[model samples]
Target: MTRSVSALKGQDTQLNCLFQFPPEQTYNRSVWFIHKGKEHESCLTDEPPLHITINYTERFSLAANIKNGSCTLGIRSITISDERRYCFRFYTNENRWTDKGGVTLRVKATPVISELYLKEPPNEGITNNITCKVSNVYPRESLNIALCADIVPKNETLSEQREPDLTFNVIKTVVFTPSKFHHQKYCTCNVTHSALQQPLLKTVIIEFQYNSNIAVGVGITTILLLFIIIIVLLYCYKQTKGKGKAMSMSSTLPTNNAAHSENAVEAPSQESQTEGNIVNEHFEEPGLVYSEVEFSQKEKQNNKPNEDQQMHMTEYSSVAFRKY
Candidate 1:
């Protein structure tokens, strides 16, 4: 039977071959590798006796468990250079030998998958993008990449890419419209490859934010604005009140100044008049004399002379006494 084995680097696999011999004899077996008809690697002699070599350099090792002319070769820690066809040949001490079919090793690169995340976290009932990035994938034909969501019944393809290294990458996306109904649903990425034993998966839970926190934030902001307005109004009112008080004080100063000026003028005139009257009354005898007494004691005391007549008499007495 013809068979081929595919594996990733740093993995192990079995290469089994069977043969028939006539009788029990000391048998020597060796596994030889060929790539494109060119000999590249070899494992010579018995079970663990041969050091596995590639390009004449020791690079890998294999162990064979032989029972009843059948062998199972265990290849350990396979590498990319180990990709080739290996065949087993057995030689008996009786000069009987045979070379038979074997396994073709096809080493493939491993697929790398990124985390699944929401494209936009803060979106409403509008559809948002969910994405996962996969890289470094080989054997593109058998690779299966997809996006999965519980809310929707379909898997969507967002994008795909191929690197210059001939390795393909995929960008899978799911268009999801979130509402309050889907507040805690989840999305996942499904990656399956021929080289992987189990499917690689990544998941992200969807979160739909309600406006209660936003409403609370707005309420707090409005209250702060009102408080600031109140403070500004109080400041303006105090400023206006202070200006009004200053204006009133300034206005009253002129009135007080005018009243003081009137009093000053009237005071000096009254003093001069009183002095003149005393001078006129005393000039009649060159001694002390009461100006009011000039009215006379025989006249009506309660009905004394008018103020104009008394003043006239004071002036007349002064002039008359001077003539005397």
Candidate 2:
């Protein structure tokens, strides 16, 4: 059966082969050959000591112990061209053995994924470009690359260049148009190859400027509400001030009316008092006349002396003074 050997480019690899022979028989010579498409080409031969063929460097070596029936071929600094089948053949005096199902060398190079990013900063309603780059890839045909936006596949332009060492460098670019809906969405790149067990991924966020329409609307609404509150407060303040003035006026009206009514009552009482004083003076006039008549009779008696003393009894007097 065929044996498989896996190695990476610029690394060393070995192919191990084993065979069994009887104790009486021993291997005389052995050779290692590599399959070149449809033909076998000898690379190493061991008549007694190992011999490397032309176009092969010391990097290609063979270690063998024929009596023990083991042979191994080592290759250093392997390349993509070294990926092929290797056969080992042995000969003895009795018979010869050539291994047709040989060991296959699979050379691989791990692709390096670069950072995924945008060519320019994103803005709303603007077109942008997203890029993903991969380098150091061997067997370029087996490399697969994909670009996605928010987990959805996107159309991209694939470009590749051959490296100086016969490897590949690839670039994948996709055009992206950003909107408010895609502000926080993600842009991702996925890379897969036969050499990698898991796909490589690089992701970036699609951030952009937001639309100002909604913000402006909200700001206007807030200002309008503030204005309405101010107007209502002013109206309430004016109404309250007006009510205070009306209450003050109403409170003073009753006091003024009561004072006027008291003054009107006191004026009639003062006039009636004056009229009563005049009537009392008119009744006292008779007493004053009787006082004057008594004084005249006293004066006439004094004129007559002792003769008037006998006349004193004839002189009648009623003196009524006004009561103090």
Candidate 3:
């Protein structure tokens, strides 16, 4: 086996083996074996007509010439499963030999920064997790993932192992406490791999939001509660005032009824007395009186009488009195 090689997946690579023996000895045949976990599997047997295993029949090829004393194994469109150590064994005439130090082929794939976003809604005064996802990376141990907030490192890296494809999905998370000062700030995700010439980076703007709707809802609820309390107080006051007025009116009702009865009885008596006085004034009659008197000789000397009417006559007088 030649020197070890680091090859990218989905590319072509070759392994060469060279050996020297005595001039009398001639090269017979060679076989290549791949190292599995605890065993080795024969991949190709290079005899006269180079034969390969069922798995490598399509994409595996070999070129060898005893004159050049070299055998090269070619692989096309390498996959992650092709990452293993390959050993070469050969038999020359009567001697069998094998190369113990096999060639190690390391397959790698570039890391792709697929997404960088917040795992939860960013609310002011709360802690949130920002996640960065990297996909399709091979040789998971070679992946270097990081998260940054404004160029400051704050990250915890985790990876998910996938089967059959031998690829990995990496997740990196950062803890952030949102505040008014952090609005519109940026967070970056960086990924590096042996297959990549430069680090893959993804930047996202973090926007923290205020919980104004919740505050408004709480305020409205408080106002409604206060208004209900005021209305209840007013209703209770009105009911109390009405009850007091009712008690006062009930206490005064008997006095008012007695005074009304007394006035009703006295009104008829006064009207009847006035009518009796008018009748007495209309029926009253006038009165008359008469009196007789004699005069002496002294009263005749002081009085003068007509000489023509002085013949013999009797003295008489009449008087009247008024009735009221």
Candidate 4:
């Protein structure tokens, strides 16, 4: 069993003393702490409060505050030379006992993001791997690499080795598939140790796939434009066909009207000619009368005829008489 604390230079830190005892033990108790071969012991007879005297070092300053159920010792700034082991002792009503071992307080330098590589920018429906390397760190187990809001890969593997400067280099790898829901995700690497009250953290920005609104908008706009183009083409085709039909009807109507006008002009002349022949027959004496129509002159008249028939060569007619 081992207890240890890690801290950075110029930072405050604490050693823990959480004592577990039997329920029956009471009335006679004592607690003490030993550091650098010096012991700060308490006496129950004198009613002196339990406390520890620290062997002050060049890196750690005065104690700021004692906290955590009076189990933790607080230090002001810590430095390189302050690295050492601390021991806690206890006594019950029966006898005295010590911890299995002791707490080792390590003064560590701040961790750094030494290297980072993204296999590729996040692509939808595809898995992406992120490799992060942390360097110049001590007590490598305290380093944490995670995604935003506890979205860490369950299978993440952490590996480390020592560097030439005696500091450690830690590597953490994560694998995940990107989604439209995670448009602007952040990946953070953190280190928490006895050196500082707050965890030291570094965050990396990453993103590639577009979110819901942008993706939806682009799809809808494309469909709308295609629909409009099809409608316009159909309208143009209908207009062209309509103009062709109108022109065909207009051309046929004028030829029909002209034929009807020529028939109207010839209709009056035919009626007048039939009426004259009837009058001449009524005025003649009763007899079998016959007449011949010929062109005596070589310069003959051009015939005026209806479109249905033609008058050519010679014509002969017979008149029949009846008693009135």
Candidate 5:
């Protein structure tokens, strides 16, 4: 049996050899060989072949499930030197021999990481560009690379280009605008190959700054609001003070007016007392002269009176003179 396998470099490769022979003719005995440089190289036999090359000794192994008539070669971490053709043969004690299909092992080169960048500036409302590239990918295999954004917009997809296996770094640029919707958006780079369905994704986050105009406007508006509040406070303070003063005046004015009226009435009473004394003195002295003439005539008529009656009259006249 012969087998061949093609795998990317630094990857594991498996080769299978299929052979069919009569069950009675061939037992479980099988021999696997490697042909390199136009020479047959013995690799493994039923007794475990000895003195294998250093490159194949550790990483190469064989599996034979003879019941299924199949042989498998497993190569781990394959390199360029591992590329070769292999052959398998089955032998039996009855002198019967059967050959299996040969195999060719090919190693493909691994792709290289290319360019990576952000699509746009790290500011709000600006379009950002994110790019990722890989070089030297196998052309025979379908290469699917994707650019994933942390925020994937509807109806948006990544773009790609292809070239032959020689130094082809696929460049994909995605345009994105930073927004509140993409507050914590992440940009990712993905790569897919024929053997792997799930893509390998690399993520990067794009940070956006707050909008300066909005911040400044908010600050200015806040200041203006504060200023208006202060003015209102001052006006209210003045109004309160004026109201207090008016209240105090309205309560005290009636008491002051009543005190002044009481003092005015007392002043008039004092002035009237001084004028009454002056009028009484002026009337007392002038009234005696008119009555004197009439009294003289009455005295002449009473000349014949007794001595005792005359004494009483004299006393009465003296008292009256003093009282006046």
Candidate 6:
């Protein structure tokens, strides 16, 4: 079986090889070798590939199925020294001729910082920018870029880069203003490689402010003024209701006084009628002094009793006394 190792480096990298041979050469045995610097190091060679090293070993392994004519090489925790050309040799039981395949290994290192910038600052009716830069990236690989803003209408931008150690700047510009409704919003920048987008390479957050204190003060003042106005209006309403009640009492007093005065006049009239009745009763009694006096007076006047009796005695007496 013949196999070729891929040119890649990592903790656990798979080396796969696919091949086809004549049925007679089916008894071919495979041998995998790792060449470091200028020396050839034997890793594994057999009909069924063998795992050459332990788990703690920095690097070693090989697996082959001579029946299927396929083999694979697994290297654990690879290092820079492991980055080299690998060879796979296939030999038949009867013949000594061997077929070989080679592969070049490349190591990937941690990403480095490239660049960072701000597009714009948050302002009234203005757009702001947030940018990030990354370096030492793989060529022709998709890059995951994101821009985050703390303000409303959060926006995100994603793109790709196709070069080694390329500088990628993702700019997210947001338009907003400082208002009473807004919270403390800021801008964030993130740069990620497509292979490992979960862990970000660079992240930055920028805060923008414009007279936030003034806006807060104004809002507070407006609320206070409204509260005061409400209190004043309530006070005025209570005062008006009190005054209406007082005025209503004052208006009713005159009618009450007039009715009382009428009642007083009627009561005196009733008393005067009762006194006249008593005087008549005394006049009817024979041998009563009051009756004799009245009879003598009537005779001296030479007036008929029936005609004089109907006249107002109090008025005639008052006139007579005045003449006297």
Per-residue accuracy of model 1 over 1-324 as CA lDDT, tens digit each? 336787777678666666667666776644444423334333322332243323222444444445466655666776666677765555677754434345678888788786578877735556777788888777777788777546673346756677765567877777666677667776678899887889998887777875666668989999999999999999999999999999989988988998866744222222223322222233344554433323333443455446665565545444422233
In order of appearance, the predictions have TM-scores of 0.44, 0.55, 0.57, 0.42, 0.46, 0.32
lDDT of 5 by residue, 1-324 (tens): 344467876787778666677666746466656553343434343333333322335687765565686767677887656666666566666754534246778666655547666755567776666777766665435676667545554334444455533324566666666687666677777877654546666777776676788779999999999999999999999999999999999999999999966754222222221111111121245444111111344445554546454444433333323224
Off by over 4 Å in 6: 1-4, 12-76, 80-102, 108-142, 146-219, 249-324
Worst 10 residues of 4 by lDDT: 310-319
Best by TM-score: 3
lDDT digits (tens) for residues 154-218 of candidate 3: 33556575856788887777776777777888777878888899888888888778777877898
- Per-residue lDDT of candidate 6, residues 226-302 (tens digit): 99999999999999999999999999999999986674422223222211221221333443323211334334455
Q: lDDT tens string, model 2, 1-324? A: 577899999999788888876667766876776644443443333332333221235887765665678878879999987888787777887876777677888888989886688888876555678889999898898999887646322456889998878889999888767776677777778899988999998888877764467568889999999999999999999999999999999988988998866744222222221111111122355335332222343354443335333233223222245545
Provide the global lDDT of candidate 4 against the true structure. Answer: 0.58
Instruction: Give Cα distance to truth, residue 85, candidate 3, Å.
Output: 1.1
**Whose lDDT is greatest here?**
2
lDDT of each: 0.62, 0.70, 0.67, 0.58, 0.59, 0.50
Model 2 lowest lDDT segment of ten: 271-280
Tell me how many clashing residue pairs each candidate has: 0, 0, 0, 3, 18, 4
Off by over 4 Å in 2: 21-26, 39-57, 93-95, 151-154, 210-324
- For candidate 6, what is the TM-score? 0.32
Q: How far in Å is the alpha carbon of 80 misplaced in model 2?
A: 1.6
- TM-score between candidate 3 and the true structure: 0.57
- Cα displacement (Å) at residue 128, model 1: 2.8
As a whole number from 0 to 100, the lDDT of residue 232 in candidate 6 is 100
